[model samples]
Target: MTPSNILSVEAYFDLICPWCLIGKRHLETAIDLLARERPDVTVQLEWRSYPLIPATPPDGIPYRDFYVARLGSPQAVAVRQAQVIAAAREAGLTLALDRIETFPNTMLAHRLVRFVRTQDGAAAAATLVDNLFTRYFMRGANIGDGHVLREALAECGIQSPLEQGASVQHDMDWLPPLNGPDDPPPRAGLGVPHFIFNGTHSVSGSRPPEALLEAMLRALARAKQIATRAVA
Candidate 1:
């Protein structure tokens, strides 16, 4: 319940996760729909960082091997890869899994996002985020690499030095929704594409844009009810 009836939508995710990228697209589409359908509703979007693998070195680990260990076998990895590729296509995203040879730590990437979001604005942060996803997932660039991040920042019109943002900490403690109750219940996990709408509604994983739009509507309705109660 913001002063100006601003609706808050937070996407909790890690950059290295492919599913998160798909989820991001769905959220973005939902944002567009919300803007067109309900122009009266003001929304605030935040991209919160949640590193999936904190143990991986900044240099990154072998891409194939990392999944092979996590998923159990090469065949399993192939199956998952195919599944992700299919899902990505449906979302209008082309993922070059073959180009991704290494899985680098995304701590610094998260830090950069934090800096850009706080210093610049949500739109600027989103452009940088989208650029990073395109570079790493589409072109197979190493997002964990400092040079790669610098290039991404430059492409997104961020002239800040990469050296200024170098924190790689992983903090995944659960807290209430972004715009929900006065006291939010704690929740924790490593799920990407997790969306919390107005702290009143939350949907996890890479769902369809329609589903996200429904959640947004529910959140807005809830906000209206809350505001009504506040005035009464």
Candidate 2:
């Protein structure tokens, strides 16, 4: 089997999830590694929306208590926060948990992402996704609000209405074919930081860049084998 160009990676994530942002950073690093190691392979990164707190209001829920309740106790949440901070540090990112006040419904943001992708392309969508995460996690902006979504898009050079025509409803009506019927379920259930490589292999969670890089290479090899078989 001979490896070729055009390796596609699709990521399912939520802007509100700190771990998801960490995953983004890790994936970015892995892509850089891919570029250096396999110059012939073109890595196509596609972002998919997977809202974590979809039912929260546009304004949002209180940040601290939301985690306290979700993780069982203040101590548990503190531990989680500490863990996130440590992981974020490795990826050269900060969670800024203290400044954040909202646990927002991210449907509007997803709509904006789709609109940007429709108008511009995958690169634009990736930029918007990064902005959404930065606005939510670093600067503590409420991404659920239409205004904030618009601001993020503006930062990304994508001009679009955040709310006027966009539905606040669930945006994932048509899912990407990252997984197929013949293959085993890649996950136990839906989880953010789900990464599928070349539409043939996948790995979930905010794994380190090394693991992701390995997965990407493996997917490429599998793709090459399949391509060779087809030709033969």
- In candidate 1, stretches whose alpha carbon ends up further than 4 angstroms from where it belongs are 1-5, 162-186
What number of clashing residue pairs does each candidate have, in the order they appear? 1, 0
Model 2: lDDT of residue 199: 80
Which tens-of-lDDT digit does each residue in 28-125 have in candidate 2?
99999989998888888878776666678766788887888899999999898899999899889977888888888777677667667767899999
Evaluated against the true structure, the overall lDDT of model 1 is 0.80
lDDT of each structure? 0.80, 0.79
lDDT of 1 by residue, 122-178 (tens): 889888989988988989998888678778877888756444553323332221123
Top-scoring candidate (lDDT): 1
Q: Look at candidate 1 and tell me the lDDT of residue 178.
A: 30
- Residue 232, candidate 2: C-alpha displacement in angstroms: 1.6
- Listed in order, each prediction's TM-score against the native is 0.86, 0.86
